[model samples]
Target: MSKPIFERDPSDPERQKINPALKLLLELGPLLVFFFGNARGEWIAERLPALAGIGGPIFIATALFMVATVIALAVSWALTRSLPIMPLVSGIVVLVFGALTLWLQDELFIKLKPTIINSIFGLLLLGGLLIFRVSLLRYVFDSAFNIDEEGWNKLTVRWGAYFLVMAVVNEIIWRNFSTDFWVAFKVWGFTPLAIAFTMAQMPLISRHSLDEEPAE
Candidate 1:
């Protein structure tokens, strides 16, 4: 039997590796589709006609977002023979909340999707570290970096806190702002913040990287 996703060793040489750029594109493609679908929902609905029944711009975007997310996950599974833990979890939430949004014609469910996903991730990471003394982040990112245990602990804390903060940020944005603004922030704002935060962790990763050369 195939190993569970969380148990699979990302660093294992036997695992098929996706190109970094393609991997990123796969991850971001759905969000881009969500943004565009919302922005041009009427244009798209006019052409497709079928999507008109889905309701407004946000609802239309939610439907397209669900399809895109499924496609991304399918591609990932096809290439890697296993789903990625983080994206897989996020995709499940997208499908669930997206369905609720469509069936009820309520935008609130879709709006709350990010907040829910981020909060779950944040709590999982934090709980693992604080209660179990384990760095769960290591499993998710082990393929990307070869940091030592100490580095993993520190990275876990930072990422856990970051996820929680993002959850709160998502709540604030969707609650206070217009739908367009929320969608834009989801695509533009959240992406940049995550990228910047990841970049900022490079020094910590480098410092604890097992691949680093020994001092002369």
Candidate 2:
């Protein structure tokens, strides 16, 4: 029996590879849209009129974010015939929380979405390591990285910790800051932090890389 359309066989030679730039755009585009929607919610609402029923700026942003996320996932599936696990998981949370935010007219649900998603990811990654002695990160990044088991273990630990930290940070910011500030941080602050953390791991990745040529 053939695998499901959404399940990618990474080892298959025929599997289409997405360009790195395009992949980054697909992942980041929705967040950008969310930020823009929030900043220009009045403008957008006035022009579209239908979206004004969604409520204020934050609510408008959440609705746009949800739509953009669905589009991103659909594009990924259409191009590759598979959804990336992390984004797919995030998208599900966005849809659920976004719906709750819109229907209940409460922005709190949308604010908590990141906290919930990050906590889930943190627990899954750490729990997999603790209980199964497996680095689930390996499965996620295997296509992009080739490293020893030790590297994967260390990477998993770092990422799990980082995710938990992000969850805490999200909680703090949303609780204390204005909605606009929180949205800005989510788009600008968290993204740079994640990028910096990934860059910081390059040395560890290099040390454990299986692709290194054997020294004579």
Candidate 1 clashing pairs? Answer: none
Model 1 lDDT at residue 38: 99
Model 1's alpha-carbon lDDT is 0.90
Cα error, residue 212 of model 1, in Å, equals: 3.7
- Report how far residue 103 has shifted in candidate 2, in Å: 0.4
Write down the RMSD of candidate 1 (Cα, Å).
Answer: 2.1
Cα lDDT of candidate 2 equals: 0.90
Off by over 4 Å in 2: 9-16, 214-216
Give Cα-based local distance difference scores for all models. 0.90, 0.90
Residue 86 of model 1: what lDDT?
A: 81
Overlapping backbone residue pairs in candidate 2 total: 0
